[model samples]
Target: MSENKTSIRKKHMEFTPMVPETTFQYADLSIKHIDAENTLAMVRRAIRMGYDAVAINIDLGDISDYYTELDMLWTPGSQNNVDGEPPKKKKKKQQRKDELADGIAGILKKKLIPPPHYVDVSQLNTSELEKRGKVFRQFSRITFTANEQVVINKVFIHPTILSYDIVAVRPGEPSVLDTLSRKTELFDIITIDHLEEERRKWLSVSKVMDRIRNDGVFYEIAYAESLMPATRKNTLFNGRVLIRSLKSKNIIFSSGAETMLDLRSPVDVMNMSLLWGVANNEARKMISGFPKNLLLQAECRGTGNGDVCSMKLSDAEKLAGNGEEEEQDGASEEKVVVGKEEEAEKVKAPPIEVRMNHSQYQALLQATKNANDMMKKIKASKAASSS
Candidate 1:
């Protein structure tokens, strides 16, 4: 029976790559000629090359125009003429508090561009970037830390935060000891792109694999070009290099897709994995297991089922039998349904006569009031500090 189940699972198992909604509409290859077309092509090709998932970049650079437009649209009424022109009155000295409030309000309303998913703003000294991070946090499901560069005189220091997942060094060079000393926190997954070949060189793909095995850093490597046929040869080389050097159990492949055209349908990613010499069972795990594990670590939802360890596929006939049993139980329960009015009346019924003493009730009320007062004070303090 076990052997038959394994055979059945092998026959039915299909790999599916999950693409984000924003990039779903632009998955076609023909749209590659549009502005920033190469990014899409690279992603598609990467998918064809067996990358199971893609990361979309939402950097400040890409959304600069949108930010500019929003800023113009959301400009303060006091700062503009009634006719939508700049204030023509003689300049008056503005209070620091008012100016700060206006600036913060403009940014909070999406007046500025949004940053990309992987780019962390913590390193930047700009107050605007800090504000942007806070605002974006509300809508963002993934938590990201910035990669800061520290420079003293002419020498460079390694980034402070270094872990298998979130390393301080770029892709090419070893991080300097001085910089590593300032280390703070670690991320579960650190993204490495081709642009920083220097830091990437410090740790080879094999080294990254070892870290993934020994430490639990989930590394995401991004290739610059469209990950399809044109880049297939090089991608395969890199893929083989990483796969052959590392123990197979530790590696996860993904497409670093940033734009609309960069997305690959889940079906395509599954097929591509098969072509990349990933075993059938392992390929399914790569497309499903890796992303799911990463999402859970990041405290995100709706990515995968959040099960990275294993999957069990059952026969449809067995499922049908189970469904029939459930249907019969449901049918019997449904025969005694209550209307909304009846439900409301049942809920309105008085509780059994169990009463607390006056002293106990008074104590409970006092405790609740105290808790509320404490909460209010804390909130007020936070508001005052932010202001």
Candidate 2:
């Protein structure tokens, strides 16, 4: 118990208050699946390598019959033109239709499972790693597979999709990329699958990349693809094009590993990024800073203009520790003061020995015993009266 208290105090002393934790120092934001055991092992491996977070990705095959941006103009709470007068009833007819469509979409969404969450950092004890000042956070991500231009505005607001912390779209059409690049609120990341030859054309020129960057959306590079023989050349070639276009801004590297074997450490990914002509600092930022901004952007998409924040538990924990320490210090000081006062009261003259006849000695001893008993009774009475 003493050891535990000492260790806790040491951690609290080292902590910085209100300063944001470097939670995104090394994040594997794309973990491919939600397998119970395999994902757990992969996350454990990631944590061991100092990754702060992972997003369990669930594939959204296609977003169909979603409410469009135009539809919101007629809805009760219009996303745009809030200062303008409420839309007339004639304009609201379309919103009513969209609401009916939304009902159907909600019914369809009922069959879908919400993203899985793993609250434990380790198997042994959840608090163990926290005590050691390390944290592993898990988030849910939905990667929508967009195969058409209509797919962009066609995404329905499914409850499950809204529940996810990250929204990543995999576009098969260049039009989808062009559209999503401007509408940043719709998604957080635009992921490209390097395995397909045609997917190269999906990235056209600097125009789309500029819009994406201006909007604060990140283009994710799955580093695991580089480990493949056939896809390696394409990954490098296209990656170079993206870096040239975006100038290494708003780009984040994630494992996107389907299994533990495909997983690469952040250091390894940083080294591999050199092949794309990214400098050391830029490569480091890809795993740390860019992803940090990406998560903030994602949370904003879900919360709109609201003041929602995703903060580490460590800061709040430090506050609680500070409060507890102050209380303990005050208590200890009070104990010291009380001890001194009690000692002063306990001070008394010591008994002196004197040679005497046995009878005289016995009488004196009895008298002393009676006097001690009387003193104890008087002290008890005084204590009761004081209370």
TM-score of every candidate: 0.35, 0.60
Quote model 1's TM-score. 0.35
lDDT tens string, model 1, 318-365?
Answer: 222322332232221112124655542111111123144434434443
Model 2, 222-266: lDDT tens digits are 878888898888888877888888888888888888789988888
Native-referenced Cα lDDT, model 1: 0.37
In angstroms, the error of model 1 at 175 is: 3.9
Alpha-carbon lDDT, every model: 0.37, 0.65
Error of 1 at 217 (Å): 1.4
Enumerate residue pairs that collide in model 2.
none
